[model samples]
Target: MSKIVMFDMDGTLLDLSFDDFIWNECLPERHAKIHQLPLSESKEKLYQFYQSHRHTLVWYSSTYWTKTVGVDVLKLQQEFQSKIQARSGCIELLQQLKEQGYICWLVTNADRASLRLKLDNIAIEHFFDVIISSEQVGYAKEDINFWQELQRLHPFNPDETIFIDDTATVLKTAEKFGIQHLFNISQPSSLKDIKQHQDLEFKTLDRLTELLSILNEIDRKDNDVKIA
Candidate 1:
């Protein structure tokens, strides 16, 4: 039987430093400039908004943010499109998965516009068998309905699936939905400190290619069980 691997786009397959720059630095500066407020004040206000909408669909929507924050968030991201980059060993892992005949899916909470922007900059789209945005599902990945909708759209055995994401909340949702193998990224952003595995709910991978060895080990264990 073939196994399916589901990956969160940003912070999993891609270096999240670009997103960190856009949200934490660029957006606040732009917001402050537009509102003629102090940078500190703007950051505090935006941080409050972020906290309120963190795992919601609106939180991931560029249009919603553009209107609420009075800045064109999508346009801002495009301005720094050059900074968008895949994580180290990202392509190598995808290529190996494709060659090895494992089905690959990109499951991201990024709204359609943001998803398009990232795909336009990175050349990893062709590697995925299916690419889904939470916007299309009408629910954020933190919501169980997103998984239900995803399964409805493209049927796959939950027990045969592996999910990798950087967010603990998203991983917990997937776990609740019964995906068998759940993994987290230790260092999602090149700009941030590495997350300790003890802090994460699932196994944390420091390198993208480490997944290949993990998959091999899982296969080995399954074969041993079958032979026994």
Candidate 2:
């Protein structure tokens, strides 16, 4: 039997601090400079925009943001691409899963342009059997249609699949879609405080490699059940 592991790229395998810095810090400054507004005013305006588009496919599109905000959001990310980084133990976890014959998929809400930027900076692309951007699916991961479209494109047994993401809303949608095992990252951004696992809806992983032991235990139980 094959076990498929689906991972969210940002905030799960990759540290989300770069994204935080780009949106919360860098973009605000640039928006202020270009619009000749106060820094505080720029942040307030951008926050409103973010709140309105939260969890939507438009929220993830760099092209849409650039046109709406009048800033080349993708170019700003490129300028600071050096800050892009993988989360701790990310490579080790991916390597271990590969060695154990698990099928790994990189399923991300990032648009194709943003996904390309991250992949260009990080060398972990070779680890995934399939890499999908929500842009191709025509919906964000927060929508059930994304999962449905993904299944239509590349069929997988949801009951045998494990999904790990940093966002609770995305996890909820995946659960609604009938994926069996789900996980949330305890600390997605190195710059931010670690989240309390008890507060999260799904089980949390503090270290990316912690998943290896969890998978081992799950397999052991499955074998015991078969033996009995």
Give the Cα lDDT of each candidate: 0.96, 0.96
lDDT of 1: 0.96
Best by lDDT: 2
**lDDT for 128 (candidate 2):** 93
Model 1 Cα lDDT, one tens digit per residue, 1-228:
779999999999999999999999999999999999999999999999999999999999999999999999999999999999999999999999999999999999999999999999899999999999999999999999999999999999998899999999999999999998999999999988999889887999999999999999998988899999
lDDT tens per residue, model 2, 1-228: 779999999999999999999999999999999999999999999999999999999999999999999999999999999999999999999999999999999999999999999999999999999999999999999999999999999999998899999999999999999998999999999999999988988999999999999999888887898899
Error of 1 at 92 (Å): 0.5
Clash pairs for candidate 1: none
Q: Give the C-alpha miss distance for residue 134 in model 1, angstroms.
A: 0.2
Pairs of colliding residues, candidate 2: none
